[model samples]
Target: MPDLDPPKRSRWTLWLVLLVCAAPVVASYFSFYVLDLRGRAYGDLIQPTRDLPASLALTDLKGAPVAAVSLHGQWLLTYVPDRACDEGCERMLFMQRQLREMLGKDRDRLDKLVLVPDDVNLTPAQIDALTAHGAPATVLRAPRAAIEGWLMAAPGHRMGEHLFLVDPMGRWMLRTPATPEPSAVKKDLERLMRANAGWDKPGR
Candidate 1:
């Protein structure tokens, strides 16, 4: 019988390659989670981080399908609000845009997202306003239940009240209070950008 040694060696090699590719992400997360981040991080860290759900269905205003996994590769600063673009929702969108802009050169490393729940549609004017700023946010419609399942709100608080942060690896990790101060949130964004600077890069 022919020797099977070469095939087994090739299999082991493949496993090694995968492990090597995953090392940087694993190491960075370990450092962030295991280290003394409690006193350092501004946003509340999610204990046992949640991965973005595969079932998260998203669609553009035109009704085109968007893969949930496609959302990976860039840090996401996300907000979920009702279909109506009320004064409060507009205020949050403004703040979210400001937060991303404040990142300076690192701005591209993060993307702003607004998840509209209940499959409701946005009016033409609302879409225009959302896309007005030079750096427009990616607004997509998602199921209300799906958003609730993936992101948790504080006790007695609605999910829309808090802003969420998802890492490049697709992990929903950090969250801010309902009325988040831009300055304070900016600090947290800076800290996160600094921490993952090594492995994370700009763009999706």
Candidate 2:
């Protein structure tokens, strides 16, 4: 009959070629996720790099569309609050601004984002107040459900209870505690900028 022996050396060579082609990708994944190499992070990893859902949209104070994509390429310090601006919301806003300022020169590398969940209507005087207290933050009005997709509650906590951190690539990276101490949060921000120095800079 025809050769009953296997393809022998040719089959072995083909298997070797396939393994060689996949080596780099496999090694990178191992080094990054499995092996926990030196540069690997201890921080929580958000898979798939969540983006602003397409169904979500925002409007500026002037009633113009504010594209969610505008947030890309800058480190974002985000807060979710209502237009009514209660005492708790006001305190959170102050903390967000102060935390950015505490970054020193690195402050320019970050942007403050306030996601208002409804069209509660801000009077011109109220707008003036927000601007006066550095509240002219990149305000965007989105549905409460859409905002919840990214900013989640911790255990019994709620979304508006804490400040969220998003990296330049638009990945939700860190979540500061509800009762965040400014000095402690400042250290965390500085650490992030320092670690990402290779890819990020101190401005837009």
Candidate 3:
């Protein structure tokens, strides 16, 4: 009779693969919840973290296709902007950029994302503003409904009024107040960086 058992080395390889895939999720949970770090987080810690939806579709300003899953592998400082791109939008953009800068050496591990929820035509100046300061942000357009389904805004406020933070694993884990204090947001970013240092590194 032929042996049905798998090789011991093959079993070890499978277990190793599973551990590698689950490390980030485990680290995040232990750092934020079990350690009571949630109490210290400036941004509201989302219970039952929401994973990035595979069905979410996105496109660039020029209408080129962009995959939503492509955003995984970096901490995301996300802002959902209106088609108009008014004063509030500009302020949020500035704040998001500055918060990443405040990360100091860990900056590259974080990416700034401006998700436009409409098809409004952006003037050259608007595009320049988004890419200003040498550190360009990834600006993409997705359907308003898709954005609404992914990011949660504070009660009595629209999604554009707040900033959302997503983990490298593509999970939506933090949501700031409608008008977040930059200093407070910075502290939260720093804490997360330190907590995940063992598993996360700069670049993808």
Ranking by lDDT: 3, 1, 2
Q: What tens-digit string does per-residue lDDT give for candidate 1 at 57-157?
A: 88887779899999999999999885576777778888888889899999999999889986556677878978887888898888898988999887888
- Whose TM-score is higher: candidate 2's or candidate 3's? 3
Q: Please, what are the lDDT tens digits per residue for candidate 2 over residues 1-204? A: 564357776788888999986575456434433454233443333454466554567777666887777777788898876446667777887888888888878888898887778745555664565566643567777777678876675677766778887766666756777667777777667666665555466555
- State the lDDT of candidate 3 residue by residue for 85-164, as single tens digits: 78888888889989999899999999998888875555688789887768899989888888889887988987878899
C-alpha TM-score for every candidate: 0.90, 0.70, 0.90
TM accuracy, model 1: 0.90
> Which prediction has the highest lDDT against the true structure?
3
RMSD vs true structure, all candidates? 2.5, 8.2, 2.6
After best superposition, candidate 3 residue 146: deviation in angstroms? 0.8
The global C-alpha lDDT for each of the candidates, from Candidate 1 onward, is 0.84, 0.68, 0.84
